[model samples]
Target chain A: MIKFLESIGTNILSWIKITQGFLSLVGQTFYWIFFGFRKKRPLKQEPILDQMVFMGARSIIIVFFVTFFTGIVLAMQSAQQLSKLGGTIYVASLVSISICRELGPVLTALVIAGRIGAAITAEIGSMQVNEQIEALDTMAINPVRFLVVPKVVALFFMLPCLTVIGDLSGMLGGYIIGVNNLGINSHLYIQTAFEYLTLKDIYTGLSKSLVFALIIAFVGCYQGLNTRGGAVGVGRATTISVVTSFILIIVADCFVTGIYYFTNL
Target chain B: MREHKVAISVQNLVKFFDGRKVLDGISLEVYQGETFVIMGGSGCGKSTLLRHMTGAMKPESGKIFFGDKDLTTLNSDETEAVKRRFGMCFQSAALLDYLNVEENVSLPLREHTTLDPKIIRILVKMKLNLVGLSGFENLMPSMLSGGMKKRVGLARAISMDPEAVFYDEPTAGLDPIVCAVVDKLILDLNKKLLLTSVVVTHNMESVFRIADRVAMLHKGRVLQIGTPEEIKNSQDPIVQQFINGRLEGPINFAENIDDVNFAGEG
Candidate 1:
C-alpha cells in the first residue's frame, strides 16, 4: 500500500512538472513572437510546412468525424434530461451554447491531443531512438526550430481552425438530432443557437483552443526531443505525452471556462 | 615533428551521473587536419566527452576551448555559431527519416546558406559522390541499409564544408567490411579535404587504419594518448590490458562484458 501510494504521489508530481513544461514552452513562444524573434532560432520553412500538413491539415478527417458524432450524442442525451423541466424545447440553447462555447473546443482538442500528441511523441521518439535529434545537434541545427516550433506553430493555428469546423459541425449535428429525433422545430433551433452564441463566447472558445493546441504540441515534442534510453524510453515518453496532454487539456478547459465566466460576467 | 596548430583543447573535464563518474579528468589537444580517434570500451564516456567538446551538453565541471574561445561559458547562439564550423556523423546515421537522401544531404547547406537550389543540388551531389553514393540521393533513410545510411550521414556531415567533423561510434553496428569502408572514407575525408576529424569508436581496426593519434579513455580520464604504434607498444598496464585484450590487468570491463569477448589483439 505504501509503495502504491508513493508511486501515485510520484506520478502526480511528474504530471505537474509536465504541465509546467508545456506552459514554459507557451511562455517562450509568446516571448519569441513578441520580443525575441531574432533570439528565437531560425526555422527551416520547408520541413515546418511538412509538419503542419501532418499535425494540422492531414488530421481534418478524424477531427470532423469525432466532432460531429459527439455533438449528436450530447443533443440526444441532454434533450432527454431537460424534458424533466418541460425544457425539451431548450435543446437548441443547450446544444448551440455548449457546442459553440465549450464542448466543441474541448472535444476537438481532446481528439487532437490523442492524435497529434501520440504522433509527435512517436515520431520524435523514433528519431530519438534512431539518433536523429542528436544528429541535428551535431549538424548545428536547432531541434526546437527544426522539430518543435513547426509543430507548435502548426498546432497554434490549426487547432483553432479545427475547433471552428468542429463547433459548426457539432451544432449542425445537434440541429439534425433536435429536428429529426427529438422533434424540435428546425427554424427555432437555429435561431436560438445563434441567439445564445455571442462573438465574445466564440472568440473565447477559439482562443482557449489555441492554448490547448500549444500545450499538446509542446508537451508531445518536448518529451520526444528529450527522450533517452532508446526504444523503451521512446515508448514511455509517447504514453506520458498523450496522458499528460489529455489531463492538462481537461484541466485547462475548466480553468479557461472559469476565467471566461468570471471575466465576461 | 611539425608544429600542428591546436584545433580543440579539452582540459580537466570531469562529469558524473547519479554519483558515478563517467568522464574523470580528460585532457587532450587535437591538431588541425588530423584524424584524432578517442578509442574506448562501451560506456567509457567517449560520446559524453565528444558531446561536451561539441557544447551540446554542459560539463558539471570542466573547460573546453575551441582555439582561445571558451565554449563552456557561451550561450546557445554562440554555441551554435561555433558548431557551424564543425560537422558531425551521429552513431545511428541520424538522417531525417522524413526526408529522402538528397534533402538530408542538403540540410546543412540549406540551413546555413542562401545559395541557389541548383548550386545546392550540385553540391549535395558532390558530397554524396565523395562518399561514393551517387544515385542513392532520392531514397529515404529507411530504404537504405545500415552501411548506406552511415554513408549518407557522412555525406551530410561534410555538406557545410566544415573545418572539423566529429564521428560518434561510426562503425559500431555495421559489418567488418562496411566498417573498413567507413574507416577509409574518414581517412580520405581528412586527406582529400584537409579537414580536422575527431572519431569516437571502440574499433581498434578502424583506429589502426585511420588515426594520426589514438586516445584511450578508461574510467573517464584518458588512460593513454599516442599513435597506434605507441598505444600498442606502451608499458602502461591499463593500456596494455585494453590493447592486449587481457582482463586480468588494471582495466576493468563494465559488468557483464565477459573477458572472452575482449580477448584478442590489443
Candidate 2:
C-alpha cells in the first residue's frame, strides 16, 4: 500500500538524519581535540586522567575475567576435536591464536561497551536532562571540549591497553587448561602457544580495539547529548547506547577482519 | 523616572515546535539596571522566549539584539563572546552536581581568565557571600536545601559579574518565605551590582515584589506589557485570569494541558 511505502520512506529519512547527527557529533569531538585549545583554552589534564583511570584501570579485572573464561572454553572445545586427529597438543596453538586474533579484542570491547559505555551515556544523559549541558553552553563552555574529549581520548588509548591485558589473561587461561586438564606438557604448551601466534595476531587485535573504542565513545556520547525527558530518558539512552555499541563493535570486527583476509595480511 | 537604555530587544520572534506555533511574533525589551519579569501560565512560551534571549535556542524568524549585537547572525566564537556578557539561572538550579560550591562558582573564572588561583578563590568567596552562602563553599550541591541550592545557583550566575542575569522561574518550588527571600535577593542584586535582570515566572507575589516592568504572555503572544501596578489593573481578560490565578476566563485549562504534553514532544 501507499501508506506502507510512506512509512518506510519516513524511517529511511529518520535513519539518514540520525547518521548525519552522529557524524557531526564525532566531527565536533575531533575538532575540539585537535584545534579547540589553540583558539580558546587548553583542556585541563585532570579530567582526562580521571577518565583514563575509570575507563582503563578499573576495567582491567572485568576484561581479564571475560577473556580468560573465553580462552578456557575455546581450548576445551578445540581439544575434543584435535584429540581425534592425535594432535591434542594443538590445543595450545588454537587457543592462543584465536584468543589474540578475535576473542581477546572482541570480548574486551563487548564488556567495555556494556560497562563504561553505559556509564558514559548515563552521566551525560543526566546532565542533559538536568540542563547542566545548557548551563555550560550559556556560560560559553563547549560541552564537547569539556566532556566528550576527555572520554574519547581516554578510551582511544585505554581500550588497546585493556586489550593487551585481555590478551595476556586469555593466554594464561589457555596455558592452565592445556597443561593441567589436557595433559599437555607445561613447557611444550608455552612454546606451542607462542610458535603459531605471530605478531600479526596481536597487532590486529589491538588495532581492532582502537576502532572499537571510537565506536563506543561516539555512540555513548551521541545518545547522551541527545537525551530528553528525565530519569526515564537517561535509562533509555544508556540502553540504546549499549545496544548500538554492541552491534557496531561486531560489525566493525567483521569489516576489519575482512580487510585483513582480503588483503592477505 | 530617568530615561532608561535598552539592554535586550526581541523583534517579532517566531518559533515552531512539531508544526505548532510555540512562539509567534513575540516582541519585548528589557531595560538596563532594572528587573523585567515575564509572567505567564505554563507553556505560554515565556521560557522559550527567555531561551532565545540567552541564545540557547534559535528562532525561526526575527532578531534578538543584546545592546547593539544581533544574536541570530553571530558565528560560534562571536556567540560565545556575547554569552560571556550575561548569565542564566535555570529552574532546577542546574549546578554541576559533581563540583563543590566554591569550585562551581569559580568555573567561569578558571575557564575564561588567566587570574591567579588565590584571586579566583577570593572572588568565589565574595560571590557566595553576596548570595549569603559564604560558609557553604565546601558543600556539594546535593548537600544544600532547595533554598540554599537556589542561592548557590544565584551565586554561580553572578560569579563573572555579568552585565545581565536571566532567571528562569527562580522561585518555582519553594516555601513562600523562601520565595520572598529570593525575590529580595533579586532586588538587592539589581541595586547592588547594577545588573540588568530578566525574570520569567508565573508567581504573582514575586512579580509584584521585584519587577520594574511586567510582560504577560498568553499562548505564545504578549498579552500585555506594563509596570506591576498596571499589570495588576490590566483590562485584558487573559491577563486578569493569570494575575488573579483564576480557573475561568479567556484562558482554557484543558487546551494548555494539551500544549504542555505537545511541548514535551519537541
Candidate 3:
C-alpha cells in the first residue's frame, strides 16, 4: 500500500514537472518571437522562411487530399439520410458547415501533427543525441531561438493557411458529389454551401487551428529537446510527439467547440 | 607556457548521476596557450569534468572559473556571454546535417555578428582551409568522411577565433594516420593562434603527442598532473595501468564495464 502510494506521488510530481517544462517552453517561444530582438540573439528570418517552406508548402498536398476525401465521405453518408427526408439539397449545407466548422481544421491539424510534428521531433531529438544542440549552446546560440522559434512561428502562421486550403478542397469535394452523384444543381449547391457557412463558423475553425498549431509545435519540440538515449530515443520521441499532439489537438478542439457552442460564437 | 596565466580553473567540483558521484571532489587548471590533456580510462569522469569546465553541465556542489568569472554563479545570459569566448569540438563532430560545409563553419559568425556576408564567407573559407577543407564548401556533412567531418567540426569550432577550445575526444574513432593529422592540426592551431586548448581523451599516443601538460583522472579524481613526459613515467599503479592499456593493475575493470553499457558505447 505504501509503495503504491509512493509511486502515485512520484507520478504526480513528475507530471507537474513535465507541465512546468511545457509551459516554460511555450513562454520562451513567445518571448523569443516577440522580445528576442532586443537581446544579443535576435531572432533570424532565414530559418523561419526555410521552415515555412518545409512545414507549410510541403504539407499542402497531403492536407488537401485528407480533407477532400473526408468531404466526399461526409457528402455520401449525409445524402443517404437527407434523401429520405426529401431534403437532399441540404447536403451542401451539411458538408460545407461540417468541413469549415470541424473536419477541415481538425483533420488538417492531425495530418500536420503526423507529418511536420513527427519531423520536428525526430530532427531535434537526433540533434540532442548527437550533441549538435550542445555545440550550438557552446557557440552561444540559443537553441530555442535558433530552433523552436522558427518552427513555432512558421507552423503558427502556416497551419491556419493549410486549414484554409483544407477547407476549400473539402467544399470542392462536396460540390463534386452533390452536383454529379446526387444530381443536385451546381449553382444551387454552391449557393446553399455559402448561405449557411457564417463568418463565425469559418473564424471558429481558424481559431481552433491556431490553438492546434501551438499544441503541435510545442509538443513536438518539447519531446525532441528532452530526448535521450540516442537513435532509439529519437524514434521514441517522434512517436510520442505525434501521439501526444493528436490527443491534444482533439482535446483542444473539443474545448474550443464547447466554448463556441455555449457562448453562441 | 605563456606565463602560466590560467584560462580555466575548477575547484572541488562534485556532481552526482542518479545518486552516484559521477564527478567527485575534483579540481584542475588549464593554462593559457597550452594543450592540456585530461586522460582517463572509460567512466573516470574525464568527459563529465570537461562538460563542467565547458559550462555544459553544472556541478551539484562546486565552482568553475573561466579566467576570473565564476561559471556556476552566472545566469543563463551571462553564461552565454562567457561561452561566446570559447569553442567546443564534440566527439561525433556534431555538424548540423541540414547545412552545407560553408554554412556550418559560418554558423557562429552569422549568429553572433552582423558581419558582411562576403566577409563571413572569407572567414569560413579561411577556417576550413586551416583544417585543410577549403573548396569543399558546398558538400553536406553526409558527403564527408569521418576524418573530414571532424576537420569541418574543427573549422566550425575555431571560426570565431575563440580564446579557448575544449575538445571532447578529438580523435576517438580515427585511423592512426588521421589521428596524427588531427594531433598536428591541434599543435599547429595552438602554436599559430596561441589558443588555449583543453583536451579530454583516452588515446595515449594523441595525449602524449599533443599535451603540453597532462592530468590523469581515475575514478573521478585526479591521479596525477604533470608534463606528458612525467605522466609517461608516473609511478602510480593506476596511472601506469591506464597509460599502458593493461587489463590487470590497480584499476578495476568491473566498475567501468557498467559505464560502457550505461553510455551505450561499445
Candidate 4:
C-alpha cells in the first residue's frame, strides 16, 4: 500500500512539473511576441513569409477535400432523418449552422494539429537533438523569435483563413447534396444557408481557430525544445505534440463554445 | 616561451545534475593565444566544463570569468555580447540541414552584421577555402561525409573571426588520416590567426599534437593540468591508465566488460 501510494505521488509530481513547464513556455512565447519588436534587431520578415506559405498555402487542398466530404456526409445523414419527418428543407439550416459554427473550425484544427504540429515538433526536435538550436544561440540569435514566432504568426493568420475556406467548401458540398440528391430547391437551400449563418457564427468559428492556432504552435514548439535522447526522442516528441495538440483543441473548443453560449444567453 | 595572459578563468565551479555532481569545485585558467585541451574519459565532465565555459550551461555554485567580465553574472544580452567573441564547434558538426554549405557558414555574418552581400560571399569563400572546401559551396549538409561536415563546421566556426574557438571532440568519429588532417588544421589556424582555443577530447594523439597545455578531468574534478610531456611523465595512476589504455589501474573497467565465453560452448 505504501509503495502504491508513493508511485501515485510520484506520478502526480511528474504531471505538475510538466504542466508548469508547459505554462512557462506559453508565457515566454507571449512575452516575446509583445516585446520582441522593441529589440535592437527586430524579428525578420522573410522567415515569417516563408512559414506562411509553407504552413498555410500548403495545407489548403487537404483541408478543402476533408471538409467538403464531411459536409456531404453530414448533409446525407440529416436529410434522411428530415425527409422521414416531411421536413427535407430543414437540412439547409442544420448543415449550414453546424458546419459554419462548429465542424469547420474544429475539424480544420484537428487536421492542422496532426499535419503541422507533428512537422514542427520533428523539425525543431531534430534541431534540438543535433544542437542547431544551440548553434543559433551561440551566434546570438533568439531561437524563439527566429523559429517559433514565424510559426505562430503564420498559423495565427492561416488557421482562420483555412477555416474560412473549409466553411465555404462544406456549404458548397451541402448545397450539392441538398439540391441534387435530396430534391430540395437549389434557390431555397442557398437562401436558407445564408440566412441562418449569422456573422456571429462565422466570427465564432474564426475566433476558435485562432485559439487553436496558438495551442498547436505552443505545444509543438514546447515539446520540440524540450526533446532529448536523440532521434528516438524526437520521434516521441512529435507523437506527443500531435496528441497533446489534439486534446487541447477539443478542450479549448468546449470552453470557448461554452463561453459563447453563456454570453449570448 | 610566450608570456601568459589569462583569456578565461574558472573559479570554484560546481554543477549538479539529478542530484549528482557533474562538475565539482573545478578551477582552471586558459591562457590567451594558446590551445588548451581538456582531456577525460567519457562522462568525466569534460564537455560539461566546456559548456559551462561557453555559457551554454550554468553552474550551481561557481564563477566563470571570460577576461575581466564574470560570465555567470551577466544578463542575457550581456552574455550574448560576450559570447559573440567566442566560437564553438559541436561534436556532430550540427549544421543546419535546410541550408547549403555557403549559407551555413554565412549565418553568423548575416545575423550579426549588415555586410554587403558581395562581401559576405567573399568571406564565406575565404573561410571555406581555409577549410579546403571552396568548391563545395552549394552542397547540402546531408551530402557531406563525416569529415567534410566537420570541416564545414570548422569553416562556420571561424567565419566570424572570433577571439577564441571551443571545439567539442572535433575528431570523435573520423578516420585516423582525417583526424590527423583536422589536428593539423587546428594547429595551423591557431598559429595563423593567433586565436585562443579550448578543446575537449580524449584522443591522446590529438592532445599531444595540438594542445599547448592539457587539463585532465577525472570524476568531475581536475586530476591534473600540465603540458603533454608533463602529463606523459606524471605519476598519477588514473592518468597513466587513461593515457596508456591500460586494463589494470585505479580506474575500473569491469562494469563495462562483457561476460561472454569466447571458447567452445561447452
**Which residue pairs collide in model 1, if any?**
B24-B220, B243-B266
Against the hidden true structure, what lDDT does model 1 obtain?
Answer: 0.84
Off by over 4 Å in 2: none
In angstroms, the error of model 3 at B246 is 1.0
lDDT of 2 by residue, A127-147 (tens): 999999999999998899899
Those runs of model 4 whose alpha carbons end farther than 4 Å from true positions after fitting are A1-5, B255-266
Residue A30 lDDT (model 4) = 69
Cα lDDT tens digits, model 1, A12-81, are: 9988986687677667655544554575445446656777788778878887888789889989999889
Which residue pairs clash in candidate 3?
none
lDDT per residue (tens digit) for residues A1-265 in model 4: 9999999999999999999998887776666778766665665788889988988999999999989999999999999898899988889988999998999999999999999999999999999989899888887777887788889988999999999999999988899999999888989999888887789999999999999999999899999998987899999999999999999999999999999999992
Q: Say which prediction, candidate 2 or candidate 4, comes out ahead on DockQ.
A: 2
Interface C-alpha RMSD per candidate, 1 decimal: 1.2, 0.4, 0.6, 0.8
Candidate 1: misplaced stretches above 4 Å?
A: A1-24, A31-48, A83-87, B252-266
DockQ in order: 0.76, 0.92, 0.92, 0.74
Evaluated at residue B4, the lDDT of candidate 4 is 93
lDDT of 3 at A192: 98
Candidate 3 C-alpha lDDT tens digits along A215-261: 99999999999999889999999999999999999999999999999
**Tens digits of per-residue lDDT for model 2 on B15-93?**
9987899999999888999999999887889899999999999999999999999999899999999999998888999
True contacts kept of 2: 0.90
Of the two candidates 1 and 4, the one with more favorable lDDT, higher being better, is: 4
CAPRI band for model 2: high
